[model samples]
Each structure stands twice: as C-alpha cells, then as structure tokens.
Target: MTGALKVGIGGWTYEPWRDNFYPAKWPHKRELEYASRHVTAIEINGTYYSTFKPASWAGWRETVPDDFVFAVKASRYCTNRKVLAEAGESVARFVGQGLVELGPKLGPILWQFMATKRFEPDDMRAFLALLPAGEAGVKLRHAVQVRHDSFACGEFVEMARAAGVAVVYADSADYPAIADVTGPFVYARLELAEEANPHGYTDAALDRWAEAARLWAAGGRPEGLPYVEAAPPPNQPRDTFMFFINGAKLRAPAGAQALLARLNAPA
Candidate 1:
C-alpha cells in the first residue's frame, strides 16, 4: 500500500504571509481557511507555547478542508523537564486539553526536545513510554524532534522504533539530522528556507524533496540523508508528513505550496 504524502507550513498566521500568500484584503480570521485549501497539512506551533479551549480547537477543525490535517506540537512543559518519567502529569494535561476536538483532522503530536538536552537512553525510554497510544477515542501518533548530536545513534533509533514513535528528520544546519524511520509514519521538518528565493527553496531543491516524499510514502528511504541505522526500515508503505519551518519564515507558505504542486503533478 502506498500511503499519502502531505506537505505544509508550520503555522498559518504571519504578517509576511498576509502580503504574499493571502489574498488582498482577506480577513485575518479567514487565514486558516485560505491556508488549509492551499496545503494538505499544517504543524500547530502555537500549541507548543499555550493551551486553547475546546471551542478553539473545534473552530480550527471546522475552518479547514475535510481532508486537511493538523500536526500538533506538544507543550514545552511536557518535554523540558530533567526527568522524563516524571512528566506524566504535564503529558496528561497536554493530551487531555481539547485535542480530541479536532477528531480525525488531528495528525501526529510533535514532542520536541531542547538543543541542550543530551540523549539519555533510560530517560528517553521512560519518556516514550509516557506517551499514550490513544486519547479519548482518537488514536494518537507521535514524533520526537531531538536536536542534540547525542541522539544521533542507532540505539536512539532502535528505542524509538520499539516505542512506535517517529524520530523527526529535521533538515537544519544547527541540528543533527536523523532520517531513521522509527514509526508507522514519516515526519520531516525542512528548515533551510532562504529569502533570496521566493519559494523558500530553488526548483531543484523542491524537486528533490518532492521525490523524497514519494519515496518515503512508498516505504523507501531516499539517499543522501544522514541516518544512524545501517539497515533500512520495513518495506511497508507509511503516511509521510513534511513541513517547511523556520529560517526564512516568510517563504514557508510558498515553499509548501510549491512542494505540493510537485507532488500533485503527474509522474
């Protein structure tokens, strides 16, 4: 089976995007409506910093297209602590906070770690165990974004795979890029956007990413990406989620749209 590929930007609201992506005179409230139509998915970065009411989540769900998905960023309180096992309360609060209101529109929850946090195998295992398999009636998917180079080891990949959690393949100059497929799905964050290019990336770069997305959807790892494990993941199709984030934030939407166009084009 060939799983679906979704390409999108981090958050929808940005003053710069209003000028380039949004229509002239478009109401600020309807920005999500416009963005959801243009991209297949979006990573909710705001959720990482603050909690919202159930009505807010529901409203967000209602504004997007039927097939659009929102990948939520887990709150910093849940992952920034010294003891991963002791974060049960924070994790519980985050999971119980109106995420189910999005229902089927919700995708993976990104558990991002700070750059200073080193990899502790035992602590990491305990943390992964803290993530519940399901919340309310909706099945939950999780992806972890580890920034420290200490996480760039086969042991980390193996542990994530055992827990059925995807290790985020962050394409950043500062962070260690771990492209191992450790879960049933693939999650990637592209962060090398440049203001010099209107689309955030050159046409060649976009094409390369488009192909990479296709390969990942087909359960194949693309070449040239850094990986800790020498062995490939199981040759089984899996859903692929990609987001254009950070760096040249102004060009993110255009980057997402351009990549989506490439994915939608004929083979």
Candidate 2:
C-alpha cells in the first residue's frame, strides 16, 4: 500500500486479547487508549453485545488517538433480521444516536447478517435501502458481512457494487472454498487457526491484500464498501478481540499482527 497500512488488535474488552495484569482488580475502563499505544485499531464488540450509554461511548472516544479508528458491529436489530425492518422512529433513534455520537471516530459499521441457504437479492436490496438513509447526509465508513455461501458469486458482487454496499470476505466452514473471496470492498473477517494456517501471512496472501489495499487507497474506495479486518492475534497479546462465532472461538491475535506487519512492510 502507498499510504500507511492501518493495523491494530481486533478488540479490547476480553481477557485473552488483553491483560488483567496491570488493571486495578475488576474495573478496566481506559483500555482503548492503552491498546492504541501498541496497535492501530480494534473492532468495538461492546456495541454489538450490549447497549452503551452516551457517557460510556464518550469515554471511549476520549481514550483513543487521532489516527486510531474503531469498527463497530451493527446491533442485533439491524443484522439479525432476514429482511430489513421498516423505517421507524426507533430505528432512527438507534442509528442517529450512534452516528451523531461516534462521529469521525467510528471506522465502519460492520453489518454482519445471518446465513441463508440461498442468495436473496431482494433481502439484500431491502437491507441496503434501510441503512439510515445517508446517516443525516454525513458519510462514515460502512460495510456488510453476509454469511451465506451463495453470497460469494459474481452476481452478488455486482449487486453489492450496484447498491454501493460491500460483501465481506471471510474464512469459515460453510463456504465451498474460502479462496473464492473477491470484491472491491475488503471487509476481511480473518479466522485464525495456528495449525490450520501456519504463519498466517503467506506471500501470496500478502501480495493480494497489498494490491487491494493500494487500489482502495488510490481513490478507489468503494462507497459504503469500507474494508475492515477482524482477526485476533494468535498469542492473544496486545488487546485483540476474541469473538466466538458459530461455536468457533477465534483464539489469540498473533495472526492479525503478522498480517499488519506484512501489509505495512516496505513495498
């Protein structure tokens, strides 16, 4: 990549991704700033699992640096449904509060949807339409992480491009080939298995990622198709996120760090 490669731990709250060593007993609120010292970013998991007060969010914003960014998971109300919900005041309230509150600090809202056996273009269309209608005319990074195997086809890519959304690239057990991932917006949900993926940063993988990143940086950023990564490090150091998705506990974040190292290495 021409510009600096954005690199960071996957998250901050969890134990294995962080440390209880220096923290005072049980309460550890100022973790984001601490994590930023060693890493560049993190996916905000707390927003997904539970609601946060404005004060809590403000505290988080205050903790991080200017360059550090946060990728927030869209709440259950938005992503859990097969079809997009109607445009209601409550929906506006949920989105508006977040958009207004998070402001520039928010990296991308990862809209991770439930898996379907078959691709439903209608469902995808509805979801795209339902997204906050321009978030009060302000554009912040946004992306969709669809989990169905059927969503990996050329049709799916075309649909996303037409709608100005991104189909996330992921490593999972459901797809025929994880190697099939290809798209403009690169929201890479990298699942790390040390033995399964030795070293994680293969030369070919680095080359592909580097090219994509370079292209994305050179004014090729897809609208609402923000690229994101959610891989925790393998050894679990440096406050990476550990999400337990579909019974697979993505362990420590060493792999993600390696990815960052590779991506940022001298071109």
Candidate 3:
C-alpha cells in the first residue's frame, strides 16, 4: 500500500450523472473539469468506439488537472481483429492518433476482447508484444480484458506476466473474474454497484475493497478475491486502480468518491 490508490468511474459524460453527480446547473462543457477535480482517474470509453483528432486529445489534457489520469479503451479496430498479430499497424495508428497529446495524464490502454474470443496463448503473446514499452519516451502500460471463461487459467496468467501485460481484474458476474496480479500495477473494474446504496457499494463492501487495495499496494494478493494462482509472489508495492462501472451506472461516481475517501486519496 505504499503507492497511490486511484478510484474513479468509467466515464464522466453520462446523462444521469449530470443530475446525480455533477453540481446543480453545472455547464455540460465543464463536466470534465468538475469530474477531474473529484476523481483521481477516469476510464475514457469514447476512444473504444471511434478515433479522435489530435486537437481533441490535447484539449482533453488541458481540461483535466495535472495529476489526473485517463485510462483509454483501445479502439475496436485493434482488439476486434481476428488475428492479433496482424494488428500491429492498427495498434500503432491507435497510439499515434493522439495519445501523446494526453502526455503524462495518459494511463493504461485497455484491450478488451470479444466475449467469444477464447484464450490463445500464442496470439495473446504476439498481441502483448505489440504493446510498446514506451511511446516517445513516456512509459506505456497495457491491460488485457479477456471476457471468455477459457482465460480463467494459470497459463494465461503466466503468459501475461511473461509479456509484462496486466490481466484486468473484472468484478462482474457476466464475466470470469480473474484477480491475478501479473504486472507491477493492479487494474480493477468493479461492476457491482447497487442502486439501493447511493454510494454504489455498501460501507462493508467499500471497506473490503479498501483493504484489498492496501494489500495490493503492499505487494500482497488480497484474500477472498478470485484468483487463478494460489498466491502472488512477494514484490515491491504497486499502484492500485479501481474503477466503478456498469451495474447501476448512475451511482458510479458516488461509489468512486466513497472509496477514495476510505483510501484517504485525493479526488
């Protein structure tokens, strides 16, 4: 738990958030400005559907605070390819599109595969190899979100670790949850938000997650979470990222804010 704990929602442009999360009468254009001030990180989902101009990326960077980080979902053109190895050009284009404009605010690039996509170790290895260690001198981080149940195996974890790629810890009933920590950092997408609890998750759930983040930051695997391996190897501390997404989306911001409060982390 020596590093930072970043708790945030998937995206800030939801229509429901305007009434529930944003300040009353807040300008729509200023939503990013406001959300950035309240959360440490944001998962940019728009990029997953389409590409943006370089100016758009630069403008987004200017809108957020200096310490705020944005984790971008890789474009479908890249992740949706049949052969991952053939996606090198698409990967380069996606990265070069305007990610550099995001600069230091850029966080990990999430590569979410189709639900039908099964685990192919060789393809996965090639895909991971395409992920650049750094772009224009700034270190790059990549997280793979494999939805198929076949990915719930020790071999997949080993392959991810070999490629230095992180296997996203997806907390969702629809997908197989793999809590293994393959990289130095932990990426979690919590989809258990409850409408009954306006803060997204109840106090007890938040407490458990806070404790888990501490454990991960301390280089230890948190007990109770689903894992392919028995335990993670002892290592140095890591930065932990937890995002509240799906399952009562309107309550996501509240859940993120509540978790941040527990971690004693700045928004």
Candidate 4:
C-alpha cells in the first residue's frame, strides 16, 4: 500500500459535541457511528485512563465502518511508571486486555510520557525494546509521545526508528514539539485549535497544516517545524495520523472533519 492519511478527533463521546458536532436527539449509542462516518479515524482516549474488556473492544470494532480506524492511547499505568523498564508487565497486560479484538480497525498504540518525565537513554531504549512487534499474529503500529525537551536529540529519533516506532509530533506550547520522523508512519497531534472558531482552526491555518501533512506523507519534513535532522529522506510513501486534541476541546470534532475534507479534497 502506498499509505493512508487519517484526520480525526481525540474521542467521540463528549457532551459538548451534542449541541455542536452531533445531531440533536441523537442516541448516545450511535455517537461512534456518526463520528466515525464523519472522520476517517479517532484517537481512543479512554484507553489512556483505563483498560476495556474484549467484548467492549469487539463492539467498538463493529460500531464503525470498515475503513474507520482507531488509535489507542496506552494507559497511564504503562507509561507513567517511576521506572520505565519495570512497566513491562503493565504493558503486556494492557495489550492483553483485548486490543486484538479491534482486528483490522486498530491503528497505532500511543504511549505518552508525562511532562516531567525526562529521556533517560538506557531506560528509554529498554522500554522501546519491550514494545511488541505484534500480538496474536496481528501486526501493530506504535507511536511515542515524549513531552520532554531531552527527546529532541538525534539519539532518541534513531532509537525509535530502529524499533519501527513513530515519535508523535505534538503541536503545543506546553510540550516540546519534536518533528523527527523516526518510523514508516507519522503521528501528529494538532493542539492549536481555538474555541472561538467552530471549525477548530482558521482556513489559513488549515491550509498550512494540510500542506505540511502532504509533505510528511511524501516522506519529506515540513518547513516551520523544528527537527533534529536538517534534511528528510526522499519522497517515500508513509501512513499519517493527525488528531486535533487538547485545544478548543469543544470544537475538536469540527476541526477533525474540516481537516479530513481538506486532505481528501482535490489539490
């Protein structure tokens, strides 16, 4: 496959979206269905706070369209540990908690470290090594979100690339925005959305981000983003996942839809 581009929101279940994104009088049970139809993918935020049962995973898989995908955020127990290496069992358990049930609909599993968590080379390397290539004969993709500035080095990018794991490109002032492409795919979190804009981002901003995503999909780094390396590789194809999160939370779904349309529209 050349690669696919997914644009979506952080989650589908939000009360605020009822009056804004979702249709009035819509059933809660149908939220996923409606949201999935509007966006190509969604970042499952619930998984970050807690684990779910196999039946739940299966039901979620059945709720959306065949082309819809979900990127799960790993639980805090696995990534927010005092010792990263010791989180092996937690990681294993989290994966075992029925992620495979999502089947073909499962996208990348995101591991987000806390803002206070610095990058310790050995510890980070050990943790990355512990991440499985696949589970139950199903291949899995992974992305890491390190909030520390220490992760902006070439070593971190090299290590992640060697493990075939992507480093999440978070667009926010609070976190260290690292744009290093370290894997076959790219994971991005656009956190600059504003509540004032019902569409999440202005048209000019959307245009800029759409162009940036195009470059990334073509295996080139986008300008105006900080990078560990000066130059990117040739135009090799890569799958891309872009999410509108942690900013203007209420307008996120609208922003996701806008970006999705932009990505799918004619050049």
Counting clashing residue pairs in each candidate, in order, gives: 0, 9, 3, 0
Task: Look at candidate 4 and give me any clashing residue pairs.
Answer: none
Superpose all Cα atoms of candidate 1 onto the true structure and report the RMSD in Å to 1 decimal: 0.7
RMSD of each: 0.7, 8.0, 1.8, 1.2
**Candidate 4 local lDDT, 1-267, one digit each (tens):** 346888998888999889568899899989999999998899999998888999999999999999889999999999998789999999899998999999999999999999999989999999998999899987889999999888889888888888889999998978998888888899999998888997878999998888888888877778898888775644678989999998889888888888878888986
Each prediction's TM-score against the native? 0.99, 0.71, 0.96, 0.97
Candidate 2 has an lDDT of: 0.52
**Tens digits of lDDT, candidate 2, 1-267:** 233345444566666344332245534666666666555667766666676777766777777887766777777676665456442443455566644465566665677766653567776666666665357555655567776667656666666666655455554555422222233233556553343443344557545554555544342332222223222112211111112122122332444455566556796
lDDT, each prediction: 0.95, 0.52, 0.88, 0.89
Candidate 4, superposed: residue stretches over 4 Å from native: none
Better of 1 and 2 by lDDT: 1
Evaluate candidate 4 by giving its C-alpha RMSD to the native, one decimal: 1.2
For TM-score, the strongest prediction is 1
- Clashing residue pairs found in predicted model 1: none
Report the CA-based lDDT of candidate 3 relative to the real structure.
Answer: 0.88
> What local lDDT does model 3 show for residue 227?
85
Lowest-sum lDDT 10-residue window in model 1? 16-25
lDDT, candidate 1, 203-259, per-residue tens: 999999999999999999999999898999999999999999998999998999999
